[model samples]
Target: MSKGLKGKLVLAISSRALFDLSESHQVYLTQGIEAYRQYQIEHEDEVLEPGEAFPLVKKLLSFNASLGRDRVEVVLVSRNSADTGLRVFNSIQHYELAISRAAFSGGRNPHPYLNAFGCDLFLSTHADDVRSALDAGFAAATILAGGTRRAQSNELRIAFDGDAVLFSDEAERVYQAGGIEAFQVLERESARSPLRGGPFKGFLEALNLLQREFPDDACPIRTALVTARSAPAHERVIRTLRDWDIRLDESLFLGGLDKSAFLEAFAADVFFDDQAGHCERARQVVATGHVPHGISNPLRDLPAD
Candidate 1:
């Protein structure tokens, strides 16, 4: 089958994720929508600061020039009305981003349009929108606002957790119910069985397609698997990826070690993990996206609000 977006890796990012909107968001929360609208209009000439996902987006777009073709597409998906979204567009012009497409939903949820955009990934600051996209089986993450450091390197390094992000949460459910010992036992026994694909599997596959466009030694994109599994449990993950025919450049099996420092050493532009605690720690060093998926996410265990 022919790919959507002409075989480009399409990403739909919320305006708040592309540019910092803390001040404007505070205005809306404290004053009201009218004041917030006026504030955006007043500052329409001012270019907004880059948000958490800006660096990643920039790196993704750089592929077009390097590869001599349009290999990636980034679309703006914002909750702002067109009138109030002028500043965002102006900022894009100021930054010279190649993004020419957008969806201004006014105040409505924008996840419904993700399918129309053929988005492989959705990054947003709004948790509700992220959850909605994930529910619809799209690779989505809530961009964390806590990261202070950014990668300065040209290589785009992306790290992902194994269970629940790349592979299904079946192992995670066992861990949550039976602890690490049982989890290891299950993994040991299931070493020959291929794990089910998680939501991010498709996203990783899309990324792998792009990576293959360049020669192995010259590829600009680097991917890593930063997982907590180690030793006896590692065989299944290796077999699983082999089964899927996906190749990750680096794989770190930390075996319950804190992933922040290792992720820092990797100099990742962005890291995705289903565990909130891992994301929280990771954001202190690198841009982090909380997947909010699988058994690790507490919200999934709770009743819908």
Candidate 2:
């Protein structure tokens, strides 16, 4: 296992992702949310689940083992109920699901807590939690647009931007903070320099480990980098990946072009970037994640709500 995950495949999933009532399951696990929240407040540690969500958790655990990934680690981040955690654990055992770790949180927000757990990725119903995970240096996704189960084929197609996903956002920060002129100056001076680390570097390492475990000789895990930076800016991105010993199947430096069309062509299961505009467009074409700007990136003006 890579040092990123600390030798564990830590996945932080919301309570809802574990169970789907639309499917057939007698014991509904969704009811215990409020109870679970209360329990957590009273007792320090507890795991809760709604009646509708347990079967799905079992399925996820089975899938994790089948994929050779570590057993699923679930954290109930919802504040709805305290009893939810206990109910969830009981259902997991009742259904004989294999789980590596299970924990519950108090009224505290789930995303920051997830960071403390060293979670590699977070799955949740709340969009804020997803965004928070990305900001906190973790790969995160919400089940809004679609489900990961849909990508159950032998190959999984994943896409990301070059600047802030694979490489550090320092250059982008310069551009945002000091405008195009300052950015140009920095890029020109740093032309021969290597790219720095970004949010998804750890994720790339994890994928490499997975590749070693499950080699896809014919149909490998398809990966791509779609970015707006062209030519001169692109060289640093490529060199950085090479230096880090990272492998990418496809990379497109679009030179300020919209990435939606290319992402559609790639048929990506998931695409990630720090810009909401790109995410807004790509979400229509594929599963998309909006990686929050790192603290170093200048805060752009927020549109009025």
Candidate 3:
């Protein structure tokens, strides 16, 4: 029988997110593909150091040891041509990562394959691919090589930003144009209303399903919603979760506070947010991924408003 992803927790991660390709990336940026390809070929035997999401991926894979089954699947999604990907595969073997599948798209967009793999989450260092994956209705994030921290908890704690992330960018558009006061009024007015599902909603729902597999008190999966909304604004979020029938283990309504210290305390295995500023801040304390979708990232021809 062929292996399938429907019953597993699937993740499609980019080579850049899985391993440190900075030197090679800089070569690609400065010299071009020829040099970069040569560099990768020359260093094919050199194992890669862990990138921001490496630790989290390792921990996630570790769960399989106890489950005695393929409860998780992490697939490599990369822009590297097949010729240049040997180094990455070698590094994966060196690290003994359980990633058995990969999509090498050369220089083209590779995100379109995410769904075929039943990817619950897609993490890449490429912002364009992240946006495209999100637009294509996958839970995607742009992994940054910062805020890689040591996890103190045994549970797989995954945290996410609310607006433009787990929830639609609708409220974010209002806030972006009207500022805090107007946005607060809108949220207050719609306190009873549930926000539309956003890019990461599917991933959250899938994660909840995994949580249900084990006893609540001892589930290996723990999720958090860390957003900038506070008080009167908090009702909609609470109601939305209730409406979705999904329960988050924790929530932080920061309103306007910096999320770094709090996330550090939370010791999140990974944090996802649409805002680069927030991602930058949170990445200093936890593995962070930037969701470059919605109003914040305006495409050349599209109106962000």
> Which candidate number would show the highest lDDT if scored against the true structure?
1
Candidate 3 lDDT tens digits, 1-305: 12248688888899988888888999999999899999999999999888878888887887777667778899998999889999999999999898889999998999878878888888888878877888888888888776767745567888889999999999989988999889999999999999999988888987787778778777787888999999989999999999999989999999889998888777788898888778777877888888878888676522120
Residue-level lDDT of model 1, residues 173-287, one tens digit each, is: 9988999899999999999999999989999999999999999999999999999999999999999999999999999999999999999888888999988888879989889
Cα lDDT for residue 150, candidate 3: 73
lDDT of 2 by residue, 178-213 (tens): 987787788777876887887778877766665555
Q: In model 1, where is the ten-residue run with the lowest total lDDT? A: 296-305
Candidate whose TM-score is highest: 1
Q: Give each model's whole-structure lDDT.
A: 0.91, 0.61, 0.85
Quote each prediction's TM-score.
0.96, 0.69, 0.93
Query: Could you tell me how far off, in angstroms, the CA of residue 80 lies in candidate 1 after the best superposition?
Result: 0.9
Instruction: Return the number of clashes found in candidate 3.
Output: 1
- lDDT preference between candidates 1 and 3, better one: 1
| Sequence-dependent TM-score of model 2 | 0.69
- Provide the clash count, candidate 1: 0
Give stretches of model 3 more than 4 Å off: 1-4, 151-153, 300-305
What would you estimate as the lDDT of candidate 2? Answer: 0.61
Best-first order by TM-score: 1, 3, 2
